[model samples]
Target: MTASYPHTRLRRTRATAWSRALHRETTLTPADLIWPLFVTEGVQVEQPVAALPGVSRWSVDLIVDRAREAVELGIPVLALFPNTQPDRRSEDGAEARNPDNLMCRAIRAVRDALGDRIGLLTDVALDPYTSHGQDGLIDDAGYVLNDETVEALVGQSLNQAAAGADIIAPSDMMDGRIGAIRAALENTGHSNVQIMSYAAKYASAFYGPFRDAVGSRGLLKGDKKTYQMDPGNTEEALREVAMDLAEGADSVMVKPGLPYLDIVRRVKETFAVPVFAYQVSGEYAMIEHAVAAGAADRDAMVLETLLAFKRAGCSGVLTYHAAHAARLLHG
Candidate 1:
């Protein structure tokens, strides 16, 4: 049977790749990718993260190579996370404020090698440096103290800024830390350093692989529900974003990208500011596992998931698949 169609047929434009490209409302590019790299302590060492397949922790020397690779790939920014040695981990997480710590060394090394070619976004949380594997200072009861944590974070931010970090990313989810960090940065001669707050970070189960990558999974005593947002709440996510923005955050991030795209869209719409999402370690692992099990195509899944962030109004995304996706987009 033949059916009559309307004069404007959407299928006509969708019939060709060129037509689709010309009509594409959203675009993904290497410029929209922020590659996340883990830095370890050694020379020319690359330790593979078992939980996060295809991801590895590179030493300071090798991190320079990775930075060069990112520059060659046209990736504008790199987010650095450190895997502090167990001996360096302490109850006070004081290593986070060390001028010569692993994170500071990597920042200085990359800045010295690459100069201003790329932006360095440094994580300001203390979980990697803490013996208790918490993002902040804890009392005897093990509760993460908000004010004390903010003070430590201010110091951490200043340390990174002194080490030439271009962006200070406070991922601790602590209240009022953004304003404190921003003020500290301004007073300490780092007025240009940006703050990308993990504004609506949730205490989600998807962070297990990340914890392992940072070497904090085994050390974590309890959940971060007391600080990070509850996954079930949406309005609260907006409030978080609002507070961070008001606190002078240059940008805001929604973590575990795919699962919280709704939150990303909401934040972007409500705030009308730059919104970024983290295609976190577990999200990357899920794709890798699916491909290994022959359940999906790796390349297709990576691009599709990344493009979803663009469609959801993300200014850019911090993705483990950044390099691979950039290569695919180049092709």
Candidate 2:
């Protein structure tokens, strides 16, 4: 007689922890994480962001200590964003090109301390430095100018590369900015500096905490919908990714990660390139709030969420929970 039951039982492999590990199709490791650090002006200063509980903006000196911690935790890269002082910010955001600016100082400090031990991914955008809090130069009507913005981004990319940044990540979402930055880098003898384009950043409500952390919340005049992608368009995201790739992005990123996993999976399947996702501030804040409310286990949730990124075909993730998740993975 033939077998009455199915020959293969999928649950059999998941019955034991060891079997589950052995059958795991995706893996999350400390090296796969990129920790985003916010830098402020001053010495030995650590200012907590109220909106993003457990997250703080550290001064350049303190940022080096965090870099050390990240290195010890086995995190591969650090993404730096600066809280430009009000006095320094201008309509044109000229401080962004200042070699002595906070971002550059923090980049140099980390590179001085860690050398090539870790990769530095510096954000190439103007919102942090712009008094008007737009990612690029704007008109009197507040419309973000694409070509002019791309020119500023190129200058910012060259500035960061000169400061020892390994990756110039343009999160500005300006059309043709990636190509402009890439050509500038090559011509300026930074041929090895990788361009990680924020290819599919959508205009979402999830970026509130980030704006607060960067000190741009109060300065922002209107929404960023004029430049950022629409949340309702998946096909548009694919087209954006294609344009960025053709323009010379070494890797591409999808912002506001968890809600955009479908986009991540689609981009990965379509491009088969190094794809990264940013688990944005709102996502991090929600997880923390849940843990505080006793509705979820922090350790379990952090690991599970990060592993989900890996499973969703993300080559890596830029997360605020990177260090904590790394500790759990290490344990």
**Number of clashing residue pairs in every model?**
0, 0
TM-score of each: 0.99, 0.98
Candidate 2 local lDDT, residue 221: 90
Model 2: CA > 4 A from native: 1-3
> Model 2: what TM-score?
0.98
lDDT of 1 by residue, 1-331 (tens): 5558678778999999999999999999999999999999889899999999999999999999999999999999999999999999999999999999999999999999999999999999999999999999999999999999999999999999999999999999999999999999999899999999999999888999989988999999888999998999999999999999999999999997999999999998899999999998889999999999999999999999999999999999999999999999999
User: Residue by residue across 1-331, what tens digits does model 2's lDDT show?
Assistant: 6569878878999999999999999999999999999999999899999999999999999999999999999999999999999999999999999999999999999999989999999999999999999999999999999999889888888999999999999999999998899999999999999999999999999999999999999999998998899999999999999999999999999998999999999999999999999999999999999989999998988989999999999999999999999898899
Quick one: how many clashes does candidate 2 have?
Answer: 0
Write down the lDDT that model 1 would get.
0.95
